[model samples]
Structure formats: structure tokens, C-alpha cells
Target: MDMRLEVVLLPVADVDRAKQFYAQRMGFRLDVDKPVKDDYRVVHLTPPGSGCSIAFGVGVTTAEPGSVQGLQLVVTDIERARDQLIEGGVDVSEIFHDATGLFHHAGEVDRVPGLAAGRASYGSFASFADPDGNGWLLQEITERLPGR
Candidate 1:
């Protein structure tokens, strides 16, 4: 079972705006951004230090904005990240706790749904939304679980 989840698609109201936000504001590197056709522009971006990238476009397909959903990002520290986003004027949810201490509550993350299970093996964290109402959850792992 070596199936790799290399890419994920995200929807945005404006391609250029979203591109800048991810590339400049959020610190993701631009993978690809070019005109594909008359009404479509293919854009791909990778997070600062990750293997996977997110692809998005305008008029490329009929996929509606805020529909792609559910991105789980684990950070070394959740409180720091939350503060940064909050200082940047992004609306963040109150931290909540999952059954596991490693997971925190982010009250009603607008679009994307919750996690599956056992993500909080280390510590807990929370999330907020991007400009276009897309969801982004920052999970903070406190420690390592038992065993390998």
C-alpha cells in the first residue's frame, strides 16, 4: 500500500489573488501558473517544506469554490501559528479538545469537515479559513505516541 497522495485541488474565487495569498502571504512556493486555455489558468503551489502541492484554476472545470475541503496540516506549534494568522487578520475559531489530548477544537471551521481519528497522538491544535472561505487546520502534536 504505497499509494501516494501527492496532490490536492483547492477552489478559489480569484486565481491570481489566491495565488498571491498562498505564495506570498502563506509562504508556499509556486509550482505552476500559466494560461491553459481561453478561460482557464492552471496554477499549482507547494507549501514551504512539503512534498505535496495544491492545484487550482479558474474556468477550468465546474468545481465550485469552497468545495474541495478537509486539509490536515500538522505544525510543531499550534498556538504560535494561530497567533500569526490572527495578527494577520484571519478569523480563527476557539480551541476545542478532541477525545485525544493531541487534538484541539476549532469551533465550526466553516467549509471543510473534521478529522478521521488518532491525529492527536502527540498534542492538540486547531485551524482557520483562507480568504476564499477554504479551510486550513493547524494541528499541533505535543508528543510522540508509545511504540514505534
Candidate 2:
């Protein structure tokens, strides 16, 4: 059996505001924006070149707005991706790598200045957030590991 991640649900205070942030600012493609009833609405979006998508809206989730964190988006070039995000009006962090030369520590614990030495795959990263503070990390993966 092959299981795949298809959609992630995000909680938001205002659906339209979240929609604008993802669709206009983040540049995600809007797949759906439908009201199932007077009290229920769902907005679905997918990032460019991504198979999984994100959804948010009224009555969709009980989680608090801005509660989600550490969501990652993989890219072939961290610098280009970060630049595109900045040009699109997103506030992104400066590119950095973990001091331990492995995965990054949570919440800026071991963040070192500048890109990883030799620009190793999966080593460089930048961070940003949505209007509701759903944190996102852009990880530069130039090559995939075996079995990925």
C-alpha cells in the first residue's frame, strides 16, 4: 500500500484573509473555494510543483489560528525561492544553516549565520509565516537522499 499526504487543514480566524495570503502573496494555486453551508466553507490551495495541498476555512478545524508551525517546503535553490517569496511581499528570514551540520534545532536554537558550508543539500533554509502565523520553512534540497 502506498499512502500519500494530500491535504493539510489550517485554522484561520478569517477565511478570506487567509485566502488572499496564500493565493495572492504566497502564490499558491487556488484549487477550491466553496461554501458547503451557511456555517461551513473550505478553501484549498497548492503550492507550485507541490503534490500536497493546504485547506482552511470556517468550521473546518478546532485548532487555534496561527497554531501550526514548522511546516517545510523543499526547493532546489533556497536563495531563488527566498527571493521569489520576498518579491511576492512575504517577509522571509535570512538564509541560515544549523550549527550542528544536521537538521536545524527548533525555534532558532542552533541557527548559524549564512548558508551551509559547500551548500549541501537539505542544509540551507529560510522561514516565513502566514497571516495567522502558521510558520513555514523553505529547505534547499539540491539532491534527494536514497529512497526519497
Candidate 1 Cα lDDT to native: 0.68
Best by TM-score: 2
**CA lDDT, candidate 2, residue 56:** 95
Ten-residue segment with the worst summed lDDT in candidate 1?
109-118
> After aligning candidate 1 to the native by TM-score, how far in Å is the CA of 122 from where it should be?
4.6
Residue 82 CA error for candidate 2 (Å)?
Answer: 0.5
Candidate 1: segments with Cα more than 4 A from true spot: 59-61, 87-89, 99-123, 142-148
Point out where model 2 deviates above 4 Å: none
Question: Over the stretch 1-148, how does candidate 2's per-residue lDDT look in tens digits?
Answer: 9899999999888899999999998899999999999899999999999999999999899999999989999999999999999998999999999999898988889999889999999999999989999999999999999999
Worst 10 residues of 2 by lDDT: 101-110
TM-scores, in order shown? 0.73, 0.98
